[model samples]
Target: MIRNEIKIKSEEGELFDKKQIALAIRNSTFEDDLKCSLLEDGILDKCQGCSLKYICNGIDQVVDSYMEKTTEIVNNFNFD
Candidate 1:
């Protein structure tokens, strides 16, 4: 799917940062463990004040879960 489609499919449904999520996914390995650790361990703390934080938080209902949801979005991403 294209970036717009991905954004629409996301839980935030247009309220989040599709580009940031895409970038995070591209930067990550998408491994379950790593994703979990990133969220659980403050690895994404840099995103704390990001404008997309609400969308990211909406993805998992936890602001820190940005990496986890990003991985999920990337893993399930489809190209058309």
Candidate 2:
């Protein structure tokens, strides 16, 4: 459902505009989906008996951090 009219090139030889990229990213599914998939696949359980869980903010916090960083990137990315 993406519109084909969104096209802009940057000064450094970029072929797409930041706004267009942002819109495409905004419409994509991510963040929670990845978290759920990783959790369900037992990836988060790797920290169940880790000694550095507290120091590393635990697996849940790590996943939350990933989601936060993804959101930040999708919100602040630029073609430049």
Candidate 3:
């Protein structure tokens, strides 16, 4: 049988509906907060010589661009 409702377990052991988790993540400040924390902890020094250092350096911008495009695509999707 196919299941219509899907659930995910959090690190805290709480069960949440997949849609609920998706919505929560979509509206969260996790990326910005993580960037702030990394900057505060001097992530640049830690990421020295890493191949993805350049991408990680501007992750906020990259995520913003990706989200913008994703939102546009979702908004333009044909749900009919």
Which is the leading candidate under TM-score? 3
Task: State each model's C-alpha RMSD to the native.
Answer: 13.4, 14.8, 10.7
User: CA lDDT of 45 in candidate 2?
Assistant: 64
Q: Write the per-residue lDDT of candidate 2 for residues 1-80, one digit (tens) a residue.
A: 65554675568764766666444444444532223344568767665775665744554464565457775533655697
Each candidate structure's TM-score, on Cα atoms with residue i matched to residue i, is: 0.23, 0.24, 0.27
Q: Global CA lDDT of candidate 2, please?
A: 0.53
- Show model 3 residue runs off by greater than 4 Å: 1-32, 36-38, 42-52, 72-80
- When sorted by lDDT, best at the front, the candidate numbers are 3, 2, 1
How do the residues 1-80 of candidate 3 rate in per-residue lDDT, one tens digit apiece? 54334565579875758665444445554443333445467765566676776866566565566577676433555678
Model 3, position 31: C-alpha lDDT score? 45
Instruction: Give per-residue CA lDDT, model 1, range 33-79, as digits (tens).
Output: 22344556876667666666676556544434654555443356569
> For candidate 3, what is the TM-score?
0.27
Better of 1 and 2 by TM-score: 2
Index of the highest-lDDT prediction: 3
Clashing pairs in 2: none
